[model samples]
Target chain A: MSNEITTRMGDGERVLFSAEEIREDIRVGTAQAAERAGIPALSAEEQEKLFDIIADPSRIVSVQPGEEVIVSDDGCSMSFYGGQDGGGVGAPLSRMQAVLTYERACGADTTSLGHSDYSFKPVKPIINFEANDYYNTSMVTTAPFFYGAQPNLGLYFQPDGPCPNAAELMPMGKIDAARQAQEEAAGHLTRDLVFVGSRLADVGLEGLNLDTSGSAGDADFLAALNAVARLKEKVPDLPILMGASGEFIIGMHGEVEYDGQRLAGLYPQDQVKVIETAGADIAGVAINTTTTESLPWNLSRSVTFMKAASEASNIPVHANVGMGVCGIPMMEQPPIDSVTRVSKALVQIGKADGL
Target chain B: MNKEIFESAADAILRGDPEKAAEVARKGLGEGIDPLTLISDGFVPGINKVGDMFECGQLFLPELVKAANAMQRATDIVNAAIPEGEGQTRGRIIIGTVEGDVHDIGKTIVVSLMKANGFEVMDLGRDVSTDRFVEAAEQFNADIIGTSALLTTTMEGQRRLEYKLKETGLKKRFKTMVGGAPITQRWAKRIGADAFAENASEAVKQAKALLET
Candidate 1:
């Protein structure tokens, strides 16, 4: 149904998300792979996993790593080192190395997950607090480095600055402070995203990154423009899925002046421009967390944030119900049903708007 | 007083005013109402509406996530009111997105589910290495350790985890479960994993099942 109706972007980028096209993609890329192994495709109730046995040209068994180690997640009872405060990098590193060692040890267990290329390249776990330049346009776009190794999935991306954990909602942008954080993180962190990618390859996971080191509001908008310009130059044909957090909306929520009764109804119009200019084909907005406190509360804050943002953004918007259904009690495990319910409710608005 | 406060609280949430919603919920509690009923009747329905709106594309991720935060405040109020020990829960679990793979969406979902279900959850967060998993388990005294690897390359890390546990002799200390976009029961067995659940729901089942083992 959706796959056949092809829509090309204004930039002539062919964006294909028709029902059939998407189905074929799922069938060929994910479903077929599962079928080949004689396994059923994962249900929404099932987690997504990727498995591969790479046959590469290069031999990797010979090279030693920046550090040789086994990695495992066995719960050794490590204390938090306050990561970047420089209070305890050593313990975290030691703990991290042991984990990597266990990941290596997984190899000693089976030949099926083995790769042709493997190396313990000298790289430290790059930790940064911030990425200062939301509008950083001059930096060269570096392609992810595999160097002969296939990567693992998942991207543990550190923001250019400290990622604000939101228990409450507040603040449209954190640029200057974020840049200061990046400054502190610039050199203290040992590796770049590329290094992270290569390390992921060493471990056997395909590396993925949701690059959102950009700040929110004006600087974020400028940052978006810069990133989009760079992406357009690098991969003009690429179809992008924009991931926006509800920073500004929450900021609006927490503005002491706004009445609690009506504040959620107000939306940040500027952010819509920022997202649209980012040149993404789709947008997924996540704005709250149980960790950070920009707002006074947690769960229901997402509704106003999502609604206002939806009314504002021109691109296809998808809401992220971060801790909603999972927040529901008696439900042992929140299914995709967490966001499904919210998305269902959000749709009624589209119907009302005749969209 | 019944639907009006709930609807208004929900409206406050949709308007992005969680403090107001919290205040409203607090007002209800002050009026001598049941906290459990407030949540079951008031909060859940509001969130359900938000969820529906999100599914319809009327709301975006940022909006929904924020509302989830707003709802968190409301939940905190409600949960605080619910007398302890009677809260519905299974047990504690340690979860991470695995080393190298940092897609936190699904992992976060699992963590939230654990918390909501009344299980103490120590989220090692994303791109967690094996040591941290072990350390978190030991520190949190977690009974179940769940690792997620969304990449094919990284699933091998999950595979390595089993052997690392055996080598360290920590295999018996905790029940190790692996899943992601690429993990399967065969891979789970090949790597000597105790269990593999398809998604978050299955993850809960597996986590619960392992505790009994």
Candidate 2:
């Protein structure tokens, strides 16, 4: 398809883009659109750099099998693997192996990767204004460039929130804004095999209060589902990962309206239907509990949630490992064994059903 | 003494039905039911059950928050009925998610659980600084100071709070409690924290235990 496209924006306004304009201007229109909508815009230099790498396939570099690639700033390098799937192509296992080997080589415990008492000053906020194609392309390109030696580096994108110029599209209502957002996402999907679409909740939940009304919540849910649909339409092979608290997913699956009602369920099996209906490739439940403090509960709950998600889609399920539980605040560093056990459990689950 | 009515109140809290819990609490108080009796026999038991369910993964944070809301509503009605000078509290605690950490779901769960268990919690919210922890503890006359950090990078804030307590010579004046996903009992001990709670129920136990010590 030619780059010339007449896209209907969120506000019922048709944004006419000529193939020549996009080729010449790169992402100046996206930035200008964001600025007009009162959202932040990236610096000219950053935008140029970002577009340069994405627009030109020649700028993208690949590592050959067994070639040494740098993994960390501390001069860490590892032999490259050819596979791209986690167990099959990606380097989750091999990355761990490299780390293990590196530590042993340095006369440190295989577990001692971080410093016992590392000191750092307060971090300044890094303003990120390019929240559209530039953002997606940057992540899609960067994550792999550093860790290209590892297996399965899929372009994981989460455009659950509206792009920077979303409000400009909002004149047409939430549905239109959502549709426009999806259209923008489609632009990003043209170049990369974005393997995973995550943070779908970001579309609805962003900039909204936690006590969002049922109508608003419903709109968000629809928007998220639509975002997934849009991404999938663009890249049929892309896997969509839906992120939310297990309770939230349970509520959605139960068709619980956003009336601020506390949704209680003994199990998450019922929530899987929503995932299937939304066309999610994998279910990602937030296991926001401390690994060591609540090991048994954490493991059991993760397994149960994953099993429910798995049963729903007959697909692999993943957990977003968050720190703390009801009583816990956060841990400095999780125990090596805790990390190992959880990884092993996830791997086992993946091995059994390819989750 | 209308035991069935009191039981209904407890059921409302357990079911996370705040409106029902409040309605029953108001009706019971109008009928001259003792405030302490309503709390002890009605709300406390109900919330304890919620705590148990939460620990076992039977109830998640949303359910726990609902139950806490119910308990709070009932507790407010019951507490308002008692004589002004006769108020009782388990302990006054100041809790917050530490600096550079914005995770609050876990902290919010702990806050609700602590409230359900009768602790007067002053939640300073997320991304709180060390001086703020010390300042809040001092201002609130807190018996316990709790800090939560979700990231490994921000976990140092907990240690910083511990250090500030020492530098200010308030270490012995207030008990320090540390928790989070990565915080183990060892880290708590290493940082000179008085207690390390694994979950909400354990937090209650540890808070009480720390005060006693």
Candidate 3:
């Protein structure tokens, strides 16, 4: 037919590949599969022309009713249909060994550095931050600390989940009832933790400002201590690695300078307060995402959180920027980055507070 | 002397006052100033100052975004007056926050910057998919496919899209670009991508270069 450049290169029309949208695409693709059965969209006579489109699209690029497309890069290594078996959405979930599984298996063709194997790292820094929100959410994580080691980190979700693992507000009424049925689901953490209702009777602190110099600080510290109390009651000598369950608390979803954070020498002090009150043995810290800061602030805050936690807690905090940075199952893009390193920041904070 | 205009413009834009910034730009433009000079010396300087403040514990995200918006508003005025066909189409780019990740602010900046630069943008929104990217690329004939991930879980989705593109033979058809929180240029190269941009500004430049190359 016509050999010309069909691509108009309109307003940034480049496709952004993602996994979430892929799942839906397969559904639509499978519908196309059912319609076409086995008729090839690229005809025997048009094979050369089809390859021409691969190199340049001014040729015959068509969708013959329900026929699927066979795409390839470089016009050489062509894989049939939307995927290997002409399966679109159902390809991943097919009974005959998933196409994704095959792609993940690094055969002779596996040349990528990220991995074809859907790798799941078992060991990575597991950080935690205390989120002020009543609901459990995944605050964005970033890498200022462990800056060079972005891929080496993994994120985990062990929020200060409700006793029934329910968020603070939801009707956990079913929690107690379901607990007996699923013994494994029964939670063991201490409950009804207390936080300061107001700033000190002396300090200028007032009304829920999160600075450590106030009543709200005292309340948060007391609450952390409560967790320690329960842990101590269970095991008196066990070294406790107190976790911060949040993102950042600087601004409203924290984004400004006044809302930004500084590394305080004494870190994860909320947990420290709990351990001190219970007279429990403190072990390590889990530097985590901030409550207010999402992924945008992840890298910077990850370092800051680690610094403060280590300064105050006097413990090795596992900084987790990789978990939040990758934006994996979400953006499908790699994580955002920062300039500092977690361990280095911790050491610096050590000097700041004469630690 | 030019720095004075830059500072005032930057100040106005940072305060969410694009109108004042635009007026400042017009004054400079009327005085036989180079377009690029006025852009970098006046408008861009202000935006960059705000961006720097945002980057180093100085400014905040909302404020930075707002400032960027204001700067964009002023720049649009300047750009419109530059006469038709004279301005270059920076590049057409598609950007998105990948699947499962809800954070869209960072990508929003990239989109804004690209759009402001005269690039035609087909934003697929957040929580995009690998196949959807291919679909959009094929449908739009996109020159550069961009993906942004804000979480570790979500970044893996980018790699998946890459492999899918390869297996489906779609990888070579267009330039694959990657960025976001966890994504580095090294990772982009390792994942077999065309290029990796560190920030929104860099992303626009890189995407333009990618498609042109």
Which candidate gets the maximum TM-score versus the true structure? Answer: 2
DockQ of 1: 0.04
| Residue A7 accuracy (lDDT) in model 2 | 24
Docking class of 3: incorrect
Cα lDDT tens digits, model 1, A244-329, are: 43433322112212112221212333444454565654444554332211111122233344445566677755443332211111
Residue A130 displacement in candidate 1 (angstroms): 29
Evaluate model 2 with DockQ and give the value. 0.05
RMSD of 2: 20.6
Q: Where does candidate 2 chain A have its weakest 10-residue lDDT segment?
A: A115-124
lDDT, residue A281, model 1: 46
Alpha-carbon deviation at A62 in model 2, angstroms: 30
TM-score of predicted chain B versus true chain B for each candidate: 0.64, 0.84, 0.74
lDDT of 1 at A75: 21
**Candidate 1 positional error at A45, Å:** 32
Show where candidate 1 strays beyond 4 Å: A1-355, B5-16, B30-32, B48-65, B90-92, B102-121, B160-179, B184-213
TM-score of each: 0.39, 0.54, 0.44
Error of 3 at B113 (Å): 6.1
Interface RMSD, candidates in the order listed: 15.2, 14.2, 15.8
Docking class of 2: incorrect
